[model samples]
Target: MYQGYLKYKTVIAELDSAIQLRINIVLFLASVYLVLQTSVGFKNPTYGGAPKRLPEKINCSASNRGFI
Candidate 1:
């Protein structure tokens, strides 16, 4: 939330420089985790599964993916 970011800024500003450094390190790690989590893709868009691999293994006729 926007409020949460503002609150974090205020709190970090009040911390001693040493503690602020530690908090910033944690914030950086958390941001990286959030980015990786959000950027990840899935095999099935509607219901996630193993990611599609190189040279897709979907078994189907040449013209249609659903053909047997």
Candidate 2:
């Protein structure tokens, strides 16, 4: 009976250690993913292309009022 109890305890300990290791790995991966996403956003503010803007001087007088 004592030997059986010892074996059970050992198995439980191994399982607990495995679970902790898995959790640590998942946390590490999540942190890495967040860092990469943040870096990408900072590196490229506009994902599509440069912003469009009106020319300094417009040939049309009515268009100068900013009616667009």
Candidate 3:
């Protein structure tokens, strides 16, 4: 009975350690994915995978003259 108990404890400990290692790996991968996703989003506002230029600034001074 003592030997069986020791074997069972070791098995449980090994399984627990394996599970923890897998969880850590998954969390690390998820963090890396999130970082990459955010970086890609920052590169393109339109989500079209191509970097686009910002809209040209309006010439408010010139347009206001027309209204005046």
lDDT of 1 by residue, 11-55 (tens): 877776779789999999998866655565353343334454579
Better of 2 and 3 by lDDT: 3
Residue 15 shift from truth in candidate 1, angstroms: 8.5
- Scored by TM-score, the top model is 3
lDDT of 2 at 2: 100
lDDT of 2 by residue, 1-68 (tens): 99999999999999999999999999999988777766565556554234546677756766777786
Superposing all C-alpha atoms, what RMSD in Å does each candidate have to the true structure?
12.3, 6.8, 4.5
Expressed as tens digits, the lDDT of each residue in 18-58 for candidate 3 is 99999999999998877776667655554433456779987
TM-score of 1: 0.37
lDDT of each: 0.69, 0.78, 0.81
Pairs of residues clashing in candidate 2: none
User: What is candidate 1's CA lDDT for residue 37?
Assistant: 55
Q: What is the TM-score of each candidate against the true structure?
A: 0.37, 0.60, 0.61
Best-first order by TM-score = 3, 2, 1
